[model samples]
Structures are given as C-alpha cells and as structure tokens.
Target: MARWRIWRPRSRAVPFLSLLLLAPLVFTGLKAVNKIGLSSERNYSRGHVTFVTVFTTYNSDPAEASKLPSNVVTVGKHSYSKVGRSMAILNTFIGFIQVSMPRSNVIILTDPNSKLTHGSAVILPIEGNYSRGNLMLQRIRSYIAFLEQRLEELETVEDINHLIFTDSDIAVVTDLGHIFEMYPHCHLALTFRNNKGQPLNSGFVAVRGTRDGIFKAIEFFKEVLEAYHLKYMEASRMLGDQLALAWVVKSYLPSAFSKFSKHEAFTVYNWTPPEGAGQFHGMPLDVK
Candidate 1:
C-alpha cells in the first residue's frame, strides 16, 4: 500500500499557514515559463512516437450496451449513446493523426469483442474488468498492464522513442515527434489544469521509451494504483485519477514529472466544451 506523511511545524504554526497561502503564488511564478535545457548541444533526429488510447465500441442503445459484459463497456461516465458518438470521434482522431504523422505509430487498446477498425493503427485487446464505480483506478490499471507489455517488447525495438497515451477523443493537429527531442530529460510529462479539484489531467500523458523512462512511468502508475487502493483520502476515490495523481505529486516525486505550459513548444489543453456547443480552439498557428 502507498503511504504518506505530512510534516507540521510545531515552532511556527502561523508562519507555515502564511507560507501555505503564498505557496501558490510562488509556484505559479516559478512554473509560468520553464525554459531550462531548451537549447541542447546534441542534435536529435525526428524520433518515432507511438500514440495510444483506450477505446471500446458500444451499442447506441443504453439497454443494449448494459447487456454487454461489464468488462467491455465504456469506462467513463458517458452514456452508451454518447460513447457511440465517441467511437465516431475516435475515427476522426485517428485520421488526423495519420495525416499529420504518417510514420508515427497509433495503437488503440479496446475490448476483445470490438470489431471496429481504425485505419493504419494497431489494435490491442485489453484483459479484465473496468468498473464504473472505480473508473479512474481501473483505467490506470489497464494502462499499467499495457505499459508492462510494451516494456518487454522495447528490449529489441529501438525505433519507438516516445509513448504518448491520450484520451480517445484527442486530435493530433500536427506531428508531435519533436516533443521527445525537445524534452529529452522528461521521463514522464503531465499536463496541469486550472481546476483545484483535479489539477492534474491524466487524459494526456507522454513517457520516454527508454528503459529508465518506462520504469519510472510504471513506478508512478503503481504508486497511484496503490494510493487508490489504500483510499489515500476521500477525494482520491471521489475525484478519481486526477486527485490521486495530485496526492502522489504532493507527497512524493514532486519534481520527477515534467509540467508543461501552453507557452512551451507543445502542450495539451483541456478542450472539453459543452454538449452541442461546438466552439473549438484549434492549435495555435505559431506552434511549430
């Protein structure tokens, strides 16, 4: 089980609270623009990036979807009909990726029963169940299993440089092959949201394919899994993966993960708009 301890200052209680109040401001200023190591001496090539996402097809009817095995149902809080819409969106996502990065690898982890096809993308079937009640933990477990399988294959495969795990609906506007080269030291990259409830968004995660990078990612996921199981706090279970990830970052490995901002070369944004509110913000034209 994952365990954490908080240290409280006995000598200066008021000062600690004051620092806590000011910590956010300090953190914001420090992380607003991180430009260290931007210009590296080594010239790296455009490496291959493998993009992976979890996708499962379901009937448009809720009743029919419910009849399917619990393991095969869509993992999120969306309705069966909405999940059907997501299937369509994922097809478009795959198409954009193929057009943008023709040489990149796109893999989908879906249920074994899914007959849906994605063009030029490798489909791998997942094992075990994903309960709606524990959606975040179950999703993390599935991703962990997938990473483990890939780690074994990485021993002989040298072509893949980075492994990017994204939500099924995420679209690739351009080739992301430069991310790994830009942030060579980034073993794991996590995107932060403005919301306090769940600050760390797990929808987009990138991990280096090197031996050390994969091991660090697995360790991080294992920590989150253990924290979820141990019920680290009420919010950890209530808010799901994001809260659990926040807790892990707070208690341990604070500097282990790279937190990217929109000012950087590439950053993933939370592009969730209201239903039927089609206001979309495409990638910045200046992004290279």
Candidate 2:
C-alpha cells in the first residue's frame, strides 16, 4: 500500500506537490551564478579534471619577515615564496589547464594584502587576516578554512576530476604536463612525506574531484578545525596542517590516499636547518 493516498493526475493534491518541488526558488530566490559557459563546464572531456591550482595567503606578508634572515623568520614565509612559485607556474604551461581565480573558486576567508593582479598573473583580491589565533594557529586554521572554501567550489562545478591544491610557497620550475594522465581508480593524490604508511602533509593536496572524495576531505578537515577550537590538540605541536592531517588519516581515511615522492612531485628550498631551514622552501615537480 502507498505510504499515503496516491493522488490521481490533476487532483487537488497535485497542486500542492508542484509547489513543494518549486519551493526552493519561490521562497529563497536563489540566483545560481553560472558565468562559465557550456564549453568549459559541460563540454570538453569527461573524466578529465579541469585543473585549478590553488594559492592562499592570509596574514602572510613577507615584507616584515624580510627584516630577519630567511631561516629565522617563520611568519609569512609562503608570501615571499609566492614570488617564485607564481613566476615558475606562469612560465610553464599545461594543456587543458588555466590558472584563474574566477574559475578556481577562491574566497576571502580572511583579510590579506596583495592586489588581485600581478602583471600577467592574478593574485585575486585581499581579505581576511585570520587574526583569531597566534601565527602558528593561524596556519592550522587556514588549512581548514581553505578546504572549506575549495570543497564548496568543487561541489558546484561538474566533472572536475581532481583539485590540485598547492601552497603559495610551492613553485613550478619544470613543466607539469604529466598531470594530464588519467586517474580512473585513485581517490586522492599527493606528494611529500612517506607518512610511514600514513597520509600526512597538507602543503600540497590533490583531492579526488569526485563528490564523495571531496566530501571526505571536507569532513577530515572539519575534524581538524574542531580539534583546534576545543583545544583537544596541543597548539605548539600543531603548527602546520601536518599533525592535524596525520590525526585525521590515522583515525580515518587510512586507505584513501596515494603518495608520490618529492622527485616525482616537487622540491622544497631553504629546507633543513642548515640552509633552507625548512621555512623557506620550494616544490618543483619532476616532469619527464
């Protein structure tokens, strides 16, 4: 038997059903933003990700840090590194890939300096300083903040296979043409850190473009954010997104990620205590 009386066509109940179907538009007046035409969104190639390399710099100003040596200065390191990273990416071109803000889905989660435009490249607006926590805490918060925004963007866009999220500190010296390869079976792809059979490191993450994978990524980050707020995790130890990610993967998503070596992925400059100091670093991917 039907859960309720099944109304025949053109019955009194029919009108009420129609109203419920259109309720979202009638009540909320949601104007969906669809500036990108069919060619970009619908057409092109299916199963191929429309690559959108991401960059975020909040409370990351290198000008002040310039006063101190690169190694000693910890604050706003990615901002200064952004100089090289942005340039390297610009110099190298990848087919079917266009780095843009409007399409990439960047939000002003916090206040920041730097104009939206930089010569031919685009920085894309300044907002959100992320001043709620200390400098170290700020990065952890940003890790969550950026994902929340990016996941939202990916959800709307159709057929985006994977989202390549790289830190502003990461620069591309060689051509990233190899990313063109298909990922039919992979859910998540990333580089740096062996993780000892664990998935850690948030510097660069390639989230599986599928809705399920992205949803998992969002949930994982939410856990990190929640831990930060509740003071469950030690702030001093959890400076970057690494520790948070380690916790999330160990506790969840243990089998979801696939790791690539630094040689296969990118390089880190100004790393280690002696020279790069692990502070000012670069990630130049190996492209054959």
Candidate 3:
C-alpha cells in the first residue's frame, strides 16, 4: 500500500512516469530510507581531524545471514581471498588510519552477543528482520540506509567530520587519509568499477553525511528498492548489493525509480576490484 508519485524527466524523449514507491521520512525498526538529517554546524573540529568515524554492518548469525546474503556471503569468491574472508580488513582499515586519524572510531553492526578479539571494535546489533526483504539485494537496499541513519540516532553524527564507511572485507594496504578530504565535494567516495568494468562495488562506500551527501545515499537505496516490486527481476539479484545499487543509480523509466540523470551526482574513487566482468551492466548484478 505504498503511495505513488509522478516523475517527469526534463528531456522530451522520456514521456511520463509514476513510481509506486513511498519512502517514509521516518522509519521504525532500522531508520527509514529517506529520513536524512543535516545539522547547522559540524560537531568536531574540521582541519587535521585526529578522530575519524568508521562503521560496518556484520550479521554473522546463521539465522540472520541466511535471510539475506551478499555476493560475499553467497558465492564467496568475489574478493581475492583464501580460507574464506580473513581478518586483514579490520587491522588494515582501522590500524592503517592510526598514522593520521589515530583515534578512529570503528563500529560494527553485528548480532547482539558477538565476541571480538580486536580490542578496539565497538559492537552494535544488525537486525535481520527485513520484512520480506529476505533476499541479499533487498537486504543491501534496506541495511545500507540503516547503517547511515543509525549514526543519526546515536547523536554521534555531528561529532564526526568525515565518515570512512567501508566493508569488513576490504583490505587496505595504503593510508587512505587523503580520500576523506573529498567529503566537501564528492559527498560519497568509492571505487567505481573493476578492471572488467563491473558496477559500483557496494562493499565499500564513503558518505560525507552532510545535508546532501547522506541524503543522496539514503535516497539512492530508495531507488534501488523499485526493483523489488518488479515481476521480472528475480530474487537472486539480491545476492550482491552492487548490481541493485548500479540499477538504482542508472535506471530511467516512467515505471522505474531513479532520481538523477545517469550518475552525474557521484564521485568515483581510484580503486577498482582486482577482477570482475560487465556482463551484468544495465541489468541486475546476479549469478542467475
């Protein structure tokens, strides 16, 4: 019973369109997809930031992960890793930043009773109750915003300047302190595609959490959600968040839910996946 609104493209080639997607400005369980907030001023000192905000959502509980699994959880072979996923990312992402942003705040959205060997990990719960969003892509669409908005609920958003949002699997070999400087302009920064020209990897994305930056991210997932209502798209598409994310950013239709023209409103990072293919471009990124 979602509401419908008409979105007419400025171009004449695109006729009329109405999407039956009603994104609530306020969500209950996990914060709603469109309820973005902007403070009048930053909470922390901007220049030469000593503390950085970093968070990642991890639902390792078998019951939770089974509900919605990412490409990393499903095929499990995307990243160049052996013996499943290693703990290298935790050390690299948080450890490497100590050189510049020493007091980095690392929050992981995981199950309630999870244990951690890393003394620095701050544990938060990632609820698996995604309604009918049991599919992986649906999980990605629902949770990406949850991760962003949860920060707002904690009241710690304004206290931090740049949010270095990254996936738990990404292994950082070099110091990426400079990438945060793009917050003023890029809003969100991440690798655009892989050498094979795949879609944007949802694994790692840096959102600026400003008036427009966080708004774009939460709204971006709202658009990806339009695919869930399509009778043609399969549940398997949900296996990877990137495919759904790509479609949400580029899709154009009177019945579709994309907001901007192409991807003009994004900042592509320099890092690309070690390997991948573009066979799924313009379509859902899935294994079929």
Give me the candidate number with maximum lDDT. 1
Which sections of candidate 3 miss by over 4 Å?
1-89, 99-101, 113-117, 129-157, 174-177, 180-183, 195-197, 228-239, 252-288
The clash count for each model shown is 0, 22, 2
Per-candidate Cα RMSD to the true structure, in Å, reads 10.9, 16.7, 14.3
TM-score, per-candidate, Cα-based: 0.66, 0.46, 0.50
Per-residue lDDT of candidate 2, residues 87-194 (tens digit): 344334221133321233322223455422333333433233444344434554554565565577766776655455544433333222223233333344444344
What is the per-residue lDDT of model 1 for residues 70-124, given as tens digits with 9 covering 90 to 100? Answer: 4453434543345445665777788767666666678888656556565568888
Q: Please report how far candidate 1 places residue 17 from its true position, in Å.
A: 30
lDDT of each: 0.57, 0.38, 0.41
* Model 2, C-alpha of 56: deviation from truth (Å): 7.1
Worst 10 residues of 2 by lDDT: 17-26
Q: Measured by C-alpha RMSD in angstroms, how accurate is candidate 2?
A: 16.7
Segments in model 2 whose C-alpha atoms lie over 4 Å from true places: 1-116, 119-161, 173-182, 192-199, 229-233, 236-240, 253-288
Pick out the ten consecutive residues of candidate 3 with the lowest summed lDDT: 279-288
Candidate 3: TM-score? 0.50
